[model samples]
Target: MANYKETAKEVVKLTGGKGNITNAWHCVTRLRFNLKDKNIPDLEKIKKVPGVMGAQFSGDQFQVIIGNTVVDVFEEVEELLGGTGTGEASSNEKEGIISKLMDGISGVFTPIIPALAGTGLLKGFLALAVLTGILDTTSGLYQILNNLSDSVFYFMPFFLAVSSARKFKTSEYLALAVAGTMMYPTFLDIAKTAFMDPSVVNMTIFEVIPIPYVNYSNSVIPIIFSVILLKHVHKWVRSWMPKSLSLMFTPMITLVIVIPVALTVLGPIGSYAGEYVGKGMTWLFDTIGPLGGVVLGATFPLLVMTGMHYSLVPIAFSNRAVLGYENMIGPVNGCTNIAQAGAAFGVAVRTKNKEMRQVAISSGISALLGITEPAMYGVNVKLKRPFYYSLAGGAIAAGAAIFFNCRSFGGGGMPGLMSLPAYVHVEDSMNVVWMAVCLAIAFFSTFILTITLGFQEDAAEEVIAEAAEKKAIKNGTKHRVFAPISGKLQLLSSVNDNTFASELVGKGIAIQPDNGEVVAPISGVVSVLPDTQHAIGIVGDDGVEILVHIGIDTVKLNGEHFDFKVNKGDHIEKGQLLGTFDFEGIIAAGLDPITMVVVTNSSDFVEIMNANDEGIIFKEEELLIVL
Candidate 1:
């Protein structure tokens, strides 16, 4: 993997230097850049660069997809930019209502994904063990497995503490301290005593009291609230403590003060608030009856897409608290998954593209198995029709569930076949029938809708044909290499950004300029000319697209001192003067001009060879190895 510094330097060079960069941030797997000039960087070149999955511009943000390793990449990029390693940007821009809501939901859930997946796998294994009679419920093995399953639920506070701290940019230790207070042994003892005899303790510290030794194991709200309090307490203590002693006294004093406040006031308040929120959701369903289910089911898929499904988790936990079973959410989640599977099935049946069909089938199966990212991102997002079909199916299932008065009887978050026992209401024979009906509705609605609205053969065939043609072109030929710039030679891999320096995109060498003039690297036709004149793309005779981007974030300068030397679609030769840049002027304007030559059609070559070493290079010097 490319280190962070290398990635940032490359991005800086690609963007036309620091002057063109407005702001940068990252989310999950993408580096998002906001540029002053919309077009200074050569995006095609960046895309072809190694370590880059793709580049996309959406919602006024230029997003560079770096896959799962984006965080490390972002860290390196930040160091190169002379900023703190924190991934967040200091921007006052207010997000839209929808965006804010989505952010809030993601904030709450993203951190917990690993824990959830791990615990879920453990539970699945336990079920398998019992089903296969590997261990009796009374055996030590069964006991150990049960403890493992229960540990995750009990220590959720510790898990949330870490995730929330990262999200809030607070001291992780402080967050842990707060969680510890909530789950403290002393406090639990006091609570237990109080619950056993409420009248014995008259002088409450904060006009509130603990529920005397009630086990808060598997609790969520108390930890969340305590951490929120910890944020303020940590800030206060850090600010007040003397610099020399801060490393120790700050956390110690903060914990002392915050723990009491949490135990006496925040804990009870948070617990009650969570209870109310859950009750409110149940109340809404009760009042609206089947319509509520219909509405939630219909829109749940959209909520998931926008990453808002997490807001409903509190409700599920609350359901378990109040009724000893998770009723409203698990069934709905199962139905939603079914709906996604339905959509993928639809796409598979409709598309003629072999790749698309294969992706759809695989994603659809994953969705059915309760993992939906692949289907959602790779299929539904690409083809909009399947998404709507799934939504319709979900709505139908929700309606059927509500009409049947189906309710869960167990504590699982999302109900699957194993959780069917949870929804059984012993007194009502109709409960079983209702559960069966809801399941049938969810399954059949998705299956039938998808099959009926499946793919169109013509569209699939066209896509497949285009893919084949591209593949053939990639394999059929080799092309002449070009010198990206006229300067003293530097290895492309030595330029600092591993993505380019590693020649991940294609074989090319970097240049340390003896002077500041850029020439055409190859004999080719100009393809694109950005507005800022910071970048240019040329197609060589060998069918290779080479892109040259100047500096990092120079697009922010809005073409202030940049001068273009050619027009798009113009034919040019190697060593031809393509453009001239005022290196001093660009620096004075606060930009970095580290030019990069990239093969946009990198897949076409079987290999890229770097053929140059240290020396002054005229425009026509053979600087890259391409096979």
Candidate 2:
């Protein structure tokens, strides 16, 4: 992995800096920015960042593809820029109703996905253990594991409340209060008692009004409705309340009025709405037979691409709560996800273009893990033909799902193999068997179709030439890398750090410093200079990325005895002073004083080899040869 902090800094700078970012957020695989002016940012520079996968404009949002490490990079970017962007992006200008609604729901749910996915996996594993008799259901370990798995879902309303508050730009504490009240022990007890004995429920609140007793556990829609209502109501109250007493009375009055209203009106309304949606889905499936599945499966990606997919999220949750299983979502989702992977794999196999092939293969693997945006945007949709192949595959697999009556036993963030246990019906083993079959069919059908129908052909030579030009190097291209410090040259393997010794950070040679000064190894732009000042990243004009580490684990010194002479993005020629470090101080701190000069982008070249005999070397001497 690349240093995420460095990547974050570069991304922010490339996107017109912190000043230009009006708002920023991230999803599973991309950093999304709402810029003051999109044209001011150099999108090309953002795309060229070492770890970045791709960049594009999606509607009003400028998206940077950072693969799976987006969340970490997002946090670092936020910290580096001291934050830019507001959560009030819901009021985006001229956005369609569906687009805004989808954006809002996605914004609310995206942050919650990690917890949901983690617990979902644990839940699935627990179920498997019990089913296979590896874990006794009555055992203490089982009880502990079961609660660990179920805690997230059981208190889902609380999580949703917090996330929805941000989406609506409301007080998170107030939203959480609503959720807490709904799930309070007193409320849960009353609701449960009422369900067991309907006569005990107080049907008449004031002898004329009717109120329903309902448990809000594992529910989604009610809290969202309540919080959104709270935002507007809280604002109205604040507008009229006395300024001196506003803080005290505002929350008091808002809670007193909003809690009852939400329980009596909004909460029930959401439940009824959920019931109707569940009924509508059932009616569609029942009335149209397998045709409904085929249509939904085939059209799922289009819905996702248009940002309309979030509309189905609540329905899936509602189905699990009301029907104990979701027939409308899980089965088709499995097929669609697998189909996306298969289509991308097909592209990888059929495309002669090296870049496209690499992207397709990598994104295809991500799709299989339930993250499909990379595959969908980076490969299938880009190629056009592969997307159609995926749709065809999804349709066929979903038909099989309908025939088998496949369903999900629970609801969570994303649907794929990780959530397969959600489809397992203990009473009917066929559910698991058929779900697996559906995935297999989707993968194979899409793969075969994409291979057969192939993408529109580009001139083979032209495709190869384009890739070569982008890399800025041919098979025989050579570049010289000079020693960045006067030191004893040594094999990279002789370094104490495994990251350097194993060549995972990249192919490189190491040096035992005789002095403290480090210089530029080649004429290049400084790409990254981290805060600790222990390492520097230089992007050579020849496209090689060189990293010079001052000493092993010297970052722990916290710049105590080190000083960097150059800042990020500065241009420097070979032998120019880049930094000075304390070699003896590092040894006194019990750290290895070995310096590493690595070709971080060595894979882009045909060969990168040590040029000098391992011994004393001076700055400006030939150190490495790249071809």
**lDDT per residue (tens digit) for residues 456-489 in model 1:** 2334234323443544444435556767566677
Reference-based TM-score of each model: 0.60, 0.69
lDDT of 2 by residue, 1-627 (tens): 579999999999988787777667787787877766766666656777977877876666677878778889999988966754633433235766755566677767777878877776677677677778889889999999778777777898999998888766788999999999999998788888998988884655567766678889978888889998999999999999999999899998888888888889999898778778878888888999889889999999887665556678778777777787777777888899999999999999988778888989999998888888889987898777899999999999988898788887654646777778766655776777788889999999999999998976333335334333566587888889999888899999888887788787789798888999888999877776767888988877667779998888888888877888887667788889887988898899998888899998877888998997587999889999999
Q: What lDDT score belongs to each candidate, Candidate 1 first?
A: 0.66, 0.81
Off by over 4 Å in 2: 10-23, 33-63, 80-84, 87-92, 203-209, 240-244, 353-355, 460-627
Cα error of candidate 1 at position 583, Å = 46
Q: Model 2: which residue pairs collide?
A: 23-85, 409-422
Q: Which consecutive 10 residues in model 1 have the weakest lDDT in total?
A: 455-464
RMSD, each candidate, Å?
A: 12.4, 17.8
lDDT of 1 at 313: 74
